[model samples]
Target: MSAGWLRACALVVMGLFSVCALAKDKQPTVIVIGGGLAGLTAAYELQNKGWQVTLLEAKPSLGGRSGMATSEWIGNEKTQPVLNKYISTFKLSTTPAPEFVRTPSYLIDGTYFTAADLTTKQPATAEALKRYETTLDDLARSIEDPQNPSANNTLHALDQISVSNWLDRLQLPATARQLVNQQIRTRYDEPSRLSLLYFAQQTRVYRGVSDRDLRAARLLGGSPVLAQAFVKQLKTIKTSSPVSAISQDKDGVTVKVGSVGYQADYVVLAVPLRALNKIQLTPALDARHQGAIKGTNYGWRDQIMLKFKTPVWDSKARMSGEIYSNTGLGMMWIEPAMKGGANVVVNLSGDNARVMQAFGDKQMADQVLIRLHAFYPQARGAFTGYEIRRYSTDPSMGGAYLAFGPGQISKYWRLWEMPLQRVAFAGEHTDTLYPGTLEGALRSGQRAASQVQDLAAGKSFEPAKVVPVAAAAAAGAVAAKKGNFFTNLFGGDSDKEPVKAAAPIAPAPAPAPVPAPAPVQAPAPVAPAKVEPAKKATVKPVAKKPVAKTPAKKTPVKKAAPVKKPAAKPAATQTQAQ
Candidate 1:
């Protein structure tokens, strides 16, 4: 062969290799673990970005905790664009909370009072509530950097104590405390179990919206409708496929579920902290990440639906359709009267739910009915049948959502948001803004998708940008002032003038400050950037939560005999489950 000929042959071979490499790089495959909102969202985003994606869910269905029942789907005005994009794309219908339910009628200490009555009936309590709210707003403003909430000394100090302790320190009236505690239990499943910092951060995130507005709107059908829509758009979704183990190398990732193994260029883990802890990760997760998965607490929440032969409370007593209770059952929301009859959804959380679970399903239902009669004498024979859902005992989902205990936030907040090698973590738990919410899950999924894309392209992954709390709140304040229908309805402050909506909601407020290290220390190891071909997969086996069931019968009774009350239990022995 002539020297010129040999040179030309070499050049041709090199050109072919380059084209092959480029093609391989362009079509990276991602494996999404968990078929919940976060995983589905990650898959959707990646697929739209031209990446091949596979989603594996432990449960037979999607939606995770959000799919359990009919409830409101609330989000800040800033998150409207993102939420609307998905809602519109899926053709889902949403209706704002009805006027009757918009402003909750408080049932405090057996007394019913409308929202307007709060200021008039208990002026002192109202003033105290106002002062507490103002304090939270000021603290939220002091948290200039949402991304590093722990950087603030005040917040850090607050993190050292439970929310109950903080409230006690405020010296709120006993009735006011009861009202606040009831609200906290219903929303977060035991404020005493959560850090003050965590509670404060949540307050800041929702500063734009009032407590009533928090349950802003509901999908026409339910959360599952949206979940099903997301499923339809996914290229591949394997239900009842729980990830038992995950192994990643310089080249790609291997996920093992039951007896089958799947390989992809990248992985997105969208499971809750509890579920994530169950999966074995090869190369081992970073210490901080592992600690976070193990240390974080997931709140327990149970829902019981009761169907009646008729609209009992509304027709018989002319009562407001909602009840915030101090009983074992946390709260109840009477659904709009259906053509057939009416239904009341009872929310149980924390220790209350745990205690009731021991009473067995049927007995628990009976107990709840009995309690209902106590509150409403006319309700004695009104209940027909009921169904209960226990989320805490679910194998796939350990709890309703993440709730940070005292000190856990500072130790693991940074780790929750970090990506490990070719794997990225996402879920409401990992999201700082709108934590434990559908909006947070979506935002986290989008973020993980971006990170996975960058990793596949052999580019450095950047942390999600943090929007300033003050700026977002200011925008919300402006919108409230302007009288934007949604904003005015949801945001707490309606008197302010209109201004442009701010950036996406920011992260948790900054924590109390800590002293600087004596000397600068070396930075932690960063996940190396690399990409390689995926290898053949192997199969392994894994475990699943009970869902609330629809009531079958709607029988009613005209009247019933009085029932005995259960003995009082010690509070110390009752632990918050969710």
Candidate 2:
């Protein structure tokens, strides 16, 4: 051979180490869409597992609805391994007393009743309530698997009717029904608009739960702490990068944001299913996934986070700041505060949430303040500032969370988490257990991370864990107080029948047209609003204790029609996930 030929052969032999090093550096890549709990969890898991991850969020901040809430409470602790793991891993704190001195209260008209009060003074109402809960527990036991609810094909008939229809069948007392509506109306629509199968799934975990216990298990800083933890560990998070399109070909997936494209071996769309309405998918998602994007039922939530000059509801009034009511003002609860004052969350859910949109924020806040003043005339002047979050009007989060209606669960449950080509799904919407919950969101994220890794390794994807139908039934009847989302592991269905779009059942009367948002200014560009809370104090039911002032986060303002203001800067401003 000539000298040149010999030199080329020598170069190839010496370059072997460099070639191997380059291979090692080229890690499998994934683009996680939506920077909420699910998205953050997926990105965190994948990054730690040696995958290169790029996270995209539409909102100026992350955490999705979790960010908007005053705080979060955990549920079904003993049954959920994922939740336990997250707490220990992050060193998140959980306390038994949620700092409230008393249990929550219920309001019907102008009167207030503690849960104990109802059971004692109104025996008939309490009996009716017990009967209704027992019925739900019995019904929930029929489904062996929530994600594959049709596994108990005999129960499919329930999918054909409204939850209202079923409740009507139960012949519940009017007072009992009103109380049930209060429990459900905010997260779900009027029971008339809800699905019986969907309701049954929620009731599956209905048994063996105590509200005080559920409320006490929350992370000390709320569920947002989990999101903050993920943000700390991930590297390529791009907030405000609203992805407009996603496409996957033979080699990999490409996510588009405005004019830029980020390519990856796979993509996990961790956004709310409804949010897909705004995103373009190349070649389009299959009919099943598309049906979910169009048909998944979510509801509106209006929460006015109010800070009071005193924790009067707890200290002087012997109330827990918990109000379950029939009024337009939904539910209220106390969260931990800095020192002396109480921080209360005023919620209007479902139709009430939609209806309240007609009023300006000031009008809404005034109405809320008046509602509280009507009952607690003792604390009329104790009100401070407030922050309002109307989810239906929020551009980033179009609604609260999943509230599957008649036929939706049966039609799309199996396909909820299945990946199409290179795209996988995550979110509270996709999980069967703890659906629409913080724990569910985190668990789904971990599953998506595993699914992505499996796809790359050419290994079969493992699904969420499953409980046998016989086993679930054995747990017997327990009353569930309230729940956001509920399900057990939902995995791939390669050997199962293909999922199809739901055939419409006659829906209950459509709720009042979702109130059009007042002509309002879009969000102003700002860092996530920081809450300066008053220190938390315990209540003594019989004693009046001094309360420290927990200043409000914003000034009380007069009602004014919100005029849309021109953007001061780009609408999509990036920030750290917290």
Candidate 3:
């Protein structure tokens, strides 16, 4: 061989060896599907533990249900430790929860009832409320572990019945029955759909961990702040890149997003079960996993924020706090005063949310105003404008959160928590200890991250058992005696914090008087459309603006159409395995 030819071959051989060595030494890669709390937490945990993490979020921003609204933070003391860890890690600041003076009265059937009215105006209701508090507390205590309440036969029996049926069996009075239904709707966003066991488990989890009455502490900038913190630490994050399919082999997992394929040693599927159903998985999921996904229902609720010239439902109006109504406007409350001033937020769920979804944005706002006027006539014309966030319509998040229907716990709960080969799960739905709450999402993520770590490290992994700590035991005692049934039941504050009021802003010049919207004619309900398997196609990432607190404009209403349900196949079915 010529001298020059030999030198060239030697150099090429050395370069190839260097490339192979670098590839062999690279850290294992993990692809997290979903940028919500669970997804972000999984990514953060994996990254810290030496995994090269790539997070994919279908939405334009992170922090799934937690970041959807800006009015209030929905979490408790248990959430504080996880949140504080992130805040300290990110060097971010948070605002203390706002304190408000709540009126000691409740509005029912157009008439406001005071504390005395409980005995005189509605004696039966008073009796029922007492019974409810006692019964639920006793039931919550029977379950040694909130995460595995099914182990208790009594609790398991309750799981077979809906909350409505349980109340019926108890022979609750009419007003009390209505109040309980309303409370469930406001709290879980599903009045009749949730099981009694599920409801009790949620109650105990909060009672176990919270120091004070449970109240959501607001993150000063909003949930996106925490999301941003997680994003900054991530090695790669592809927002607006929805996963089309997931295929796994003995070697690694391949995630398909549009035309690109990302291969990772392991995968974390953190999206909602409904969202997960959209993606096709090769070597279809087993029967139990498929059944769990098909059986799970995502709860839906609509949040409406009305900016006003003043706090119309303040102490002067004889109603200082949240107001409940039967008029399909489930619950209304004024947010704590902020730098921008105070505003009223109406939460619509259950039948109320369904009724409101038919109208246009402005029409819905008008209807809400009409309902408010019925209770406080003097507050007419104080309305400035409104913004609506319909969780049902969000593409990424099909609904607010998962609500396990009756009989689903035993049939699907275990399957949902079990990991499939190469793919682990994480989300609020997978968490039994604190289901449907922000804390649950974080815990599930931690669990999934641990599982991923074990898998990558070739260690056997088992789901962690939830054991009650001293705080939960002590809190349980306090909750049994002192808990305000209505407030604590709905995961909000029953006691007010001392207020440091913000300076009031000069009311914006009143816009032209908005004429009352024409009454909308209800359309006949149509059968839900059948969802089909997603076609294999490249999905381009669409650029979206960062999530910001902007005023939503009034838009013209269009006739509503029936919402189609997505068709499910075994492989496309969702699993809660995290």
Order by TM-score, highest first: 2, 1, 3
Question: In every candidate, how many clashes are there?
Answer: 26, 17, 8
- In TM-score terms, candidate 2 sits at 0.77
Worst 10 residues of 3 by lDDT: 569-578
Ranking by lDDT: 2, 1, 3
Q: What lDDT score belongs to each candidate, Candidate 1 first? A: 0.62, 0.62, 0.60
Q: Mark the regions of model 2 whose C-alpha exceeds 4 Å error after superposition.
A: 1-25, 67-71, 75-80, 98-104, 311-317, 335-338, 378-380, 459-578
Candidate 3, lDDT over the whole model: 0.60
Candidate 3: tens digits of C-alpha lDDT, residues 1-578: 99999999999999999987775566667888998878988888877766667788765556677533453353443444555556667887655554432222456776766546667877878778777766676556655566576653334555666666556556677777677667677767554577666777666655444322244455666666666677776666776678887777666666777766776677899988778778877657777677766557556677787777776666444443465654556776656556455577788876576666678878888888888777666456677778777765455666677766666665666455656766889988887655566556776787787776656545543544433223222332333344432223323344342211211122122122212223332211111211212231112222231222222222222111111322111121111110
TM-score per prediction, in order, is: 0.76, 0.77, 0.72
Per-residue CA lDDT of model 2 for 1-578, tens digit only, reads 99999999899977987886665566667889998888888887777776767788886666776744434555434544566567787887775545452355677665667778889977888788777776676567655555555443334545666777667666777877777776776555567667777777666643355555445454566666767776777776677678877766666666777766676778899988667778987766668667777776776666787778786555434556566776666777655566577777887877677767888888888888888777667455888777787666775556777777777766666465666656788888777656756667777787787777656655544443332223222221121122211111111113233222232234454434444445543433323622212121111111222221232121222122111321111111111000
Deviation from native of the Cα of residue 360 in model 1, angstroms: 2.3
Q: List, residue by residue over 1-578, the lDDT tens digit for candidate 1.
A: 99999999999999999987676555567888987778888878877766667788776567776644454454324443445557877888887766676555666655566657878988887777666666556545544455556443334555666767666656778766766676776667566677766776666555555544444566766656766778777766676678887876655667777656776767899998878888988777667777877667666677788778776655434445556654555677777765576778887776576566566667767887877767667565767777776666565666668777777776776565667777898887887766666766777787788776655545554554432233433433322334531223222345454443321223323332212212211111111111121332111112111111222121221111111222111111101111
User: lDDT at 12 for candidate 1?
Assistant: 99
User: Candidate 1: which stretches are off by over 4 Å?
Assistant: 1-8, 11-22, 71-79, 122-128, 210-216, 315-322, 462-578
